[model samples]
Target: MTSVVITGKRYLTKPEEAEKFGPFERTYLAEGDSWMDSSAWNQGSLPEFLVRGFNRRGRSRLIVNISTSGHTLTKIVDMMNDELVWWLNQGTYDALLFSAGGNDFIDAARDAPPGQGLLFDMRGKPMPANGYDCVNPAALQRLVDYLNVNFAAIYQAVRSSGKNAATPIYLNAYDTPQARDAPAIRDLAGPWLYTAYTKNGIDPALWDQLTAGIFKDILHTITAWADGRSGVHVVPTSDLLDKAVPGSTGDSKDWVNEIHPNKSGWKKQVEAWLPLLS
Candidate 1:
């Protein structure tokens, strides 16, 4: 139960460090965005929680994490050409864990040029029935389709690798977040959802409904893609944790910021995902 997680750099520079823990029952190669990468704002992320949980269960697990904060799915795919391939081919990993799509959705929420972003300019449009109408259907579809293609590419890459051809691939969908002014770092990083909703002229009342609807669509689409696929698991996390209070500007309930969860929230999520890993 002395198992631990290490960064890809550590694994590369000191391969014997993992051996000190010795005789791990399961090893995982993980790559993703901020959810897997702990920063100054977030002390422990999903990968770290998974290691702790596995140790608690008396299962020895070592995770080689190669995730970077702020990376989009496109960037994740681009990484395949570099160090990701080396890890995939060199290790006898039990599974490949990925945490993505959140940043991609965040990027799409930007008010980019016409037809480039997910939100519609709701300025002069008639009032809609619900918050779902805040998002442009075609643009949303394009984002989902783009994510699907990239995920499929990652899947294919793992399958094509002779060493991990049969390794399980696990993906996690983010939980719904409140559209507020809570940034991981004040004035530096985010308040991502708040900016998007405000820029699109979406009413404050509709922010919660709209954010939930968007994540619901993403979860459903990703789950559908993984359906009937061999060795692919989509860990549904949309409703796992309590959402942040609507107008709070800092840590509230289970959320640390606009996107990331607090340690308690990560614990709940990891509990749900542990059975799948087992």
Candidate 2:
């Protein structure tokens, strides 16, 4: 891949303030669990797989990543209609990638725990600091409804806006982290947000329960709604993390923070995307 450039409406908060896995700059849609603090996927960090694409000895491919942190559905549509049109006019990119929805889910999770801290291990059992509400089905359902509607709109916008419908658009699924060792992360405001997966005090079994089955449902739901478009590819992280084999404690593939990928995990992310790119 060649140099990447993202163009879109920018957000007002600091990038570091996001709890999702992304490293996105201004306006990004949070779709899944891993998208919670996407600092690693921002313009600067460039997920390792994209780097590999850059290094390949083939026709040059440019990644034009136009995203911002904390972008909502209405904001995203406005940006695509306005700022993104400007970027396309500038003649950039060999391929385009889009992500969003995680923030909405995060918002949903918030409603579930309304005014309470998420203080349990991934297993949903009480932890040292365990005393908060967690994600209830009702909140998740609302977010899912929102994602289905907006995702289609986003796809239609990109496809109809003179960009090639066949332009290898890649979307991603969430990596549901094992929940056993999670802690409640309180924001600068006095609210109890979900905890980040820390390495210091993780219970392996709890992680297994947290990650097991939940992500599959998320992926399946999205894919069902997506209708298997040729231009879209959904990277399956549940399979990727299978190398860690949730139930087994001997897996060395665990990341330092029980949530974010380590070097090996990053490699797995790249591997998942490679097939789609080709």
- TM-scores of all candidate predictions against the true structure: 0.94, 0.60
Q: Please report the TM-score between candidate 1 and the true structure.
A: 0.94
Residue 90, candidate 2: Cα error in Å is 4.2
Task: Rate residue 18 of model 1 by lDDT.
Answer: 87
Residues 1-278 of candidate 2 have per-residue lDDT tens digits of 23222222232233222223233221222221232223434212223345445446342333334455455544566566566555544442334555455445434433333223221223544453322222345545655776777777767755665644445555666455544222222221111122323312334334344334435546775565457665666666556653333332222364423334555565666666655554
Those runs of model 1 whose alpha carbons end farther than 4 Å from true positions after fitting are 40-43, 111-116
Clashing pairs in 1: none
lDDT of all the models against the reference?
0.84, 0.43
Cα RMSD (Å) between model 1 and the true structure? 1.7
Candidate 2 stretches with Cα past 4 Å from truth are 1-48, 56-59, 69-75, 88-94, 111-135, 180-193, 196-213, 228-230, 242-259
lDDT by residue (176-221, candidate 1, tens digit) is 8888999885566788878887777787878878998888887887
